[model samples]
Target: MHPLDALDAAAHLAATDPAAAISSLPWLSASLADDAAAGRFARWGRSSVIDENVGAAVLPRPLFDELHARAGLEAAWPVGNAGLLHVYGYLLSTTPTPYGLKRERWLTGDLERACGLAVAALLPWIGAETLLSRATSAASALLARPDALTEEAEGRTARIALGAPLPDGTAALAYAVDGLIVTMFPVADPAAVRAGLGAPRLRWNAA
Candidate 1:
């Protein structure tokens, strides 16, 4: 299984799409080598990202998605902080196999996470702590800079760089500015990727 094939494949129990094209001792540095050549990720950037999520589409698609409305209403939490692994079908289907951060043409994935953050503000700490604790944890990510370049922010905190790393080690990076946090992954090179990979499904293109 190629490293980037995981880019297209979705959640499954038997998915064995490799993370690297060639196995290396330190797996982190080796990840982008293959995918970069094949263009698995649409962009690579180092912005003070506020919300970068892998399977961000797949990560939170179910919650705000109309399909899952019944389940969210039925289940105790999870859609927010109080979610439970279904112990069967859901655990397998929920996660996707993409390291690249994506924007749902319709922002389906973000809805759940935004709701999750709103309900429990403290949950953001989970990834931030992990990024601080383990330097290696963030090395392989799309927006890999764990620390903000700017020394002082405008207000409250020293600086704000919001990140969310899933249990799988795939994470999202968010930038905090003007005392506000927004969730759009920045692109390093606009020409490298397909035009609409990160753009809205319906967008105005200059004629």
Candidate 2:
């Protein structure tokens, strides 16, 4: 499937079956892991630490560039650490791991910082009220429906690419959903699929 088509399909999944879409996160991460183990996932940059004291996020250059370009903002603009954390938190939540304890610690430890960065990064585009509203709604829904996280669904797989370049001018991040391989920088377009479910505009601050 085409990249946008894959994106749209994922969006449809979120709209029709939010629980299933949420459950598919683990499979998506698994697909990413497989690609990474084979070196095919280099397009998605390596994970790095975000230092709150310095108020800077260490993101992949290409991913950063894509976000900047999409937002139509200058390179000098600060990337929102809270936004970055939100992205990370989502990833952590979706990751398939037996180490629930470790995951919980990591999320709870830095959730506030991540949310702050997210607001900073996204506030310009969506405004503070909208961003907060969307973020809260999303968090509430996911948290309220724990059963959604455990349900299973089935569909064919397609590779969808996000509109970002790697440092080497290759693809950025791509994951295999049930019927789509979604290629997108989560930071650039956080909660895009979920937003399609009438959540809110999670896409970067695009003016």
Note the Cα lDDT for every prediction shown.
0.26, 0.31
- 47-123: candidate 2 lDDT, tens digit per residue: 22233322333333443343323323344433322322233222322222332321232223233233223423422
Cα-based RMSD of the predictions, in order? 17.0, 21.4
Per-residue lDDT of candidate 1, residues 83-173 (tens digit): 1111111222334334232322112333223222332222111222321112122222322345532333223232223344434333333
Segments in model 2 whose C-alpha atoms lie over 4 Å from true places:
1-49, 52-58, 77-85, 88-133, 136-207
**Residue-pair clash count for candidate 2:** 13
In candidate 2 the C-alpha lDDT for residue 174 amounts to 27
The stretch of ten residues in a row with the least summed lDDT in candidate 1 is 80-89
| lDDT for model 1 | 0.26
- Per the 3 Å backbone cut-off, how many clashing residue pairs does candidate 1 have? 14
TM-score of every model?
0.21, 0.21
Per-residue lDDT value at 138 in model 2: 32
